[model samples]
Target: MSTTSNPYRGFRYPAEIINQAVWLYHYFSLSLREVELILAARGIVVSYETIREWSLRFGRTYANSLKRRRPRPGDKWFLDEVFVRIRGKLHYLWRAVDQQGNVLDVLVQSRRNKTAAKRFFRKLLKGLYYVPRVIVTDKLGSYRAAKREILPGIEHRQSRYLNNRCEVSHQPTRRRECHMRRFKSVRQAQQFLATHTRIHNHFQLRRHRLTASEHRAARDHAFVAWRDATGTALIG
Candidate 1:
């Protein structure tokens, strides 16, 4: 077990157990019970239910911590939405990513109308300082209107391939969604995606055209930022 100071002091599980639980959650797309079982075989006698609590309570907290210290996302933005099942119905996830595949923001909504689009844009512009030079989206009228209302001077491109960057960005979320059988509430889906976005941005290496060493260095640098921001180990 790790000898590090326990962040959740007096909790039955040690830092090692919590670390392992979080690791499994991020790396293996493991559910809380799966994390408990994985650790149980290794002789850590924690419960699946507690693991779930740890993840929900701490996961969002940790992810937010990492985001605070992460570098500002690049200015070339790609935006899109994906459908998530909530209570056997469809909910939309609005996602924003930078040119280098860094996730910027994620918003969940019951509708995809102009108001929904505006809300998503508000979240995206919250922490960002400089405006993106290019905002890429599909042929969505709401996005076009939101662009005009919020970021008037920003160049909005409604091209086919331009949004491939963000469309592909949802793959990890989709993978995780498959595990939970889908969210029961829109709020739950929103919360999970928000955390996942920060986690993804923390670890994503802009692996395009870089040498192995450069990629490693970039990843290491990102982790350092994550640690400084969140005060948690980059367990993945």
Candidate 2:
């Protein structure tokens, strides 16, 4: 339990309700209305609009708190970019993940050129304490150009198959995109995906690699971490 000041101070709802609402929205592909109905089923009468407001206000706060508690990321980084149509306009979604499939960062840009690649590289390095040992990407020449200037000493592997980890990681974004009926703006897409990746990845234990009991333990640990991140663990 923590002695820190309450994050839920002044809110109409208690920390537990807010925490559960935020968790449900991010941990699954559920909409705000879906979360509202779920809460209503439990006798909690909250509107979907309020749920949306809570998500917009508190999602990133919780995500950043969780990021501070994660262990150092893996040294092998996989970078990839995919085109997303926002409001019928094209935008690039840049993503980086470590070897273990943990998302490092995500950037939404208008181009996949060298400048965009360089910017994404800088964003990744700015958050990390150490440079990666290696970076894998598809045959994107911008990555090669960016790496030469930004990560001169690290190994860069360009292959269509070597970076499947990052490519597969895009599936969740795609699913969410479809669920949301497509993103309305670049900023909205970036903000939602940035927070979504952190919170979703926090609970994404690779159950296939763990025994049944181990999976349960990992899930319990994830819940505890979520509690700590959202300041709900401090609640008596």
Candidate 3:
């Protein structure tokens, strides 16, 4: 919960109604109406508009909850971008991922120019105690400029195939976009992507890299951390 005062204090719905609304709308990639329909199916009647209001009011709260739960970003980062359409126009999503491919931060902006690129770089660089060597990125000129400016020294390379690792990591975002029918606005895209990235990092285990039993153990441990962090998701 935010340290800010509650705007919903004067509202009619109960707190759980708001929380559940945000949860369903976010966790399932559901539209406000879809969340209402899903809950109605479970005998909880609520209007889609109500769900929308809840989502707008509580989306940050939900994101904050997951942020507090998420593990710190790992070292050795890869960077990439994906094309997205926001309000019938083109936009780019800049993302940073750790060596394990856990998304560290996400930014949605109108252009991938130096200014936008600098903003994205700052977002990733903030809160980091150490610098990552071997920064991987595409042939984008903006990345070249920004990397040279902000991260002067470490080994920044522009290999063609080197960034394929980050490119492949965009698969989940693409998969989820099909369900969302595309994001309506930049704000919505940023909010949803930020929360989604954190959630994805929480569940992503190096299953393919580990043996079956080892993978299972890693997954179980990740789930335990998730449960403890959220104070939900019973381990038994």
Best by TM-score: 2
Each model's lDDT comes to 0.78, 0.93, 0.74
Q: Is candidate 2 or candidate 3 better by TM-score?
A: 2
The residue pairs that clash in candidate 1, if any, are none
Write model 1 residue lDDT over 41-60, tens digit each, in one string: 99888888887787787778
How big is the RMSD of model 3? Answer: 4.1
TM-score of each: 0.88, 0.98, 0.77
Better of 1 and 3 by TM-score: 1
Q: Of the pair 1 and 3, which is ahead by lDDT?
A: 1
How far off is residue 56 in model 3, in Å?
2.5
Q: What total of clashing residue pairs does each candidate reach?
A: 0, 0, 0
lDDT of 2 at 4: 60
Q: Which TM-score value belongs to model 1?
A: 0.88
Ranked candidates (TM-score, high to low): 2, 1, 3
Candidate 1: regions farther than 4 A off: 1-7, 222-236
Q: Candidate 3, after superposition: displacement of residue 204 in Å?
A: 3.3
